[model samples]
Target: MVSRRGTKSKTPGSKRTSANPPSRKQFNPSLHRFQERYEQKEFQAKPHGIPVRVLSFMGVTVLAMSMYSGYLYASYQREVSKAQSLDVPRDVSDRYNSTAPTFDAEVELSEKAMRLGKKRGDLIRLARGDVLEVSCGTGRNLEYYDLGERRGTDDQGHAAVIGCRSLTFVDLSPQMVDITREKFQAANPEFTHVAFRAQDAGAVTVEAPARVRDLAGAGKDASDHRAYYDTIVQTMGLCSMADPVGTLRHLGEITEPERGRILLLEHGRSHYDWLNRILDNLAPLHADKHGCWWNRDIGAIVEESGLEVVEVKRWHFGTTWRYVLRPKILCGEKK
Candidate 1:
């Protein structure tokens, strides 16, 4: 009332205001709703974006691992399939032909092969009259024959004696046979007892004149259909053959009935399960590359081939086997 007396009269429904005006309580429902919506979206968007990014990273990781595993499995399968369908003739022939000229040096220098150490010497001692060495690449066994000694002068003017003998060397590769002939001849110019034949051991029928057998000082033959050899030797040769069991069976067919035996030195599967599994996993790759089955079971092959195993000795964790096998006997012939 006192202020109204000092101030001019206001119009109807008008009110006098102070120097600092009070805030109005205006209603703005649309603007408030918009602000609430924006805050809610920001809160939700922050957490949601983080989870999406994390999920995407995990998905990519899993997908990459799965693809890598699939690739490894596919590679393993390809190796296995190739091993399963391995063809003996083509693979072996190609392998020997490719390696024929230098096969002997390769065997001698290989660390794994050199483990056989003196076993080759032991094998040479086992050779007798009418001995035959199959798959005799470069005639490594030629120098160990049981020939009588001849007195000679050594390079140092010392008395030396050389021992040699005549033996037959057989291989499927003509190149290998040629190499064997050259190697043996070069090693022994005077010893003319070696005969090299390029023929498949599985297909060849054993035959020789009775006079020749007598000259070789071998025993009489057992059957008209089969020719007899005093000793049949194979070393590390069975692994590359198409059918080891079949070859053994054929050996049985040709062995002398009364007094014939086969001597073998070979590398095969380990007796230890752990090592064997590793070999199994890698056998296909090894065979593909080297042309031999490194993981084959020598004892099992012998048993399955129906050859009467006289003795078996294992070395190098059962990877190397020395076997003496008697000829196969017919069911009716068993004593």
Candidate 2:
């Protein structure tokens, strides 16, 4: 089509002939608003960067754990080396003397250390007649002994206040002996049949204040020390002894055969292989510090002592044992 005044009027849809026809409105308010918004979003949207606080926390946690692990390893190594050079320390008596007052508190430091509550009561209940407690520390067992209603011989050899014929408390520490005497006196005020001897349990010969001779009278052979005490009790004492095996052997020797029984509440080697290995690794440290072999096989020790184990109840991965032992019948004493 052609315009009235022009040679050929371009159609409305026709392209512009000018080299730089007015640029398409240079800017449209509405469209420019949208374009500015898009640019702003692009500017605001940042790259996936980690926060400084998070990085710092992670770094600090890793570093702290690593340092703690290193410190523990160093401390363990030091303890192990110190343990290896020393056989159980000879200052056990001095150690107990200094710490006797706080021994119970120290034992209570860990709930697991209680070994399934106060087994001392159970220990004392098993005693009867003439009783001898080896390594009776602080007389903790005195409060639990079933003294019964049978009165002991008084100053005039007449039955006075009711209780066992005699209860002997023995220990290596003088402080322990003193504490035991004090506790025993308080517990059995009416009964004067209690004796406290501060000496090594294994070395207790006729010199030790034992009731065997008094109870046996003059007719009984003094050499027959085993016939004196009817019951022998030990709790947690075996572990710390300078000679657990020998002391146990002596205990067996002194314990009466047939009717006599020995009750023990102790802690030692774990039954679990993994835990036993850990106990073994810590054995030297335990022996050095606590004067006891934490990894010793309690069952094995009892068997080795020539005591016939009647019943054994083990707990805490076999680290704790409640043993009922009796004297093995000698070849001559066998029926």
Candidate 3:
């Protein structure tokens, strides 16, 4: 029994009701039949995360790889110490020619993962006056340059406003050179002082522009201005070289004796022995597939090259090397 709106009906066990009561939900036979039931479920006691067998397999795999790496590490290290010229399975040029088309794609993810662009910019921004890039694969360092004629210091540490300049790129792989030319020319059609050559950088030469020749003192009549490069760059090149030391020496010969710099970003033996071991173990297989003998000690190569080290930086457990080198004459030994 309930009380009416205005008149209170005093029934013995009566209750008051609202004028507008909530409507009751209508029952449906189908919904009631399929309604959720709440009951205690058996707790799954199965171990979470990776299965025990899978974990065991993974441990075994790691142990096997480590054992394998340890076994080969010493022998491979000895072989790299020898620095054999023909250790790589294929000649550098032919290897790169076959791989040129897919080269950028192949390296794109790795380059980004390694953050090589910033490292590249750190070196390329220092390029001023006439520039020559050897092993200029796909012109990967193109966007990093502080391009155009600009004022910068010379090799002897003197501030000089050098004359007309040029940017020349050379590589042994003709296909790679063609690809580099296409990318750069398409991007900078207005810039005219650029040359992309597919040739041996160790023996190749580039004629200097009038202003560059004058700045370098090549004289008005000197037909070959080969030694006019103010900045020489190479990245990831030494690994593929038959004689990396000799090649670096040739680069030193062409660079300006007073103010030229050789900027190199290379991968090689690590400062840590364990890492060097890994690099050594992977060396032969990596070379056969990629044409890169990546375990050479870059410090030894540079020392043997006869170039004076201006600055040196290493990254990735000392496996990556960045060197700013100059001709030995810049050390100021009186002739």
TM-score of each: 0.62, 0.66, 0.68
RMSD of each: 18.0, 13.1, 12.6
Clashing pairs in 1: 147-164
lDDT of 2 by residue, 1-335 (tens): 66788678767798867777575756679998999999999988865478888899999999999999999989978876776776666334446777788877776656346544566666566677778887888776676776653656644776644345677788888988898898778767887666778888887653233444333443445454434467788888877776677888887767666567788988888878988877777776776555566776788888888888888888777888899888788665622
Model 1, range 36-108, lDDT digits (tens) per residue? Answer: 9999998976755457778999999999999999999899788767766754332444577887766667767
Off by over 4 Å in 1: 1-91, 111-114, 148-166, 208-226, 330-335
Write model 3 residue lDDT over 1-335, tens digit each, in one string: 35567665687677877999899999898766555331212234545578889999999999999999987877776665654433555345467888889999999999899899899988887777788899998889988876677576755888876433678889999998999899988887888888888878778675644134443243334454334688889999988887788899988887877778899999999889988877776676677667788889999999999999999999988888999999898443521
Instruction: Report every candidate's CA lDDT.
Output: 0.73, 0.73, 0.80
> lDDT of model 3 at residue 202?
75
Better of 1 and 3 by lDDT: 3
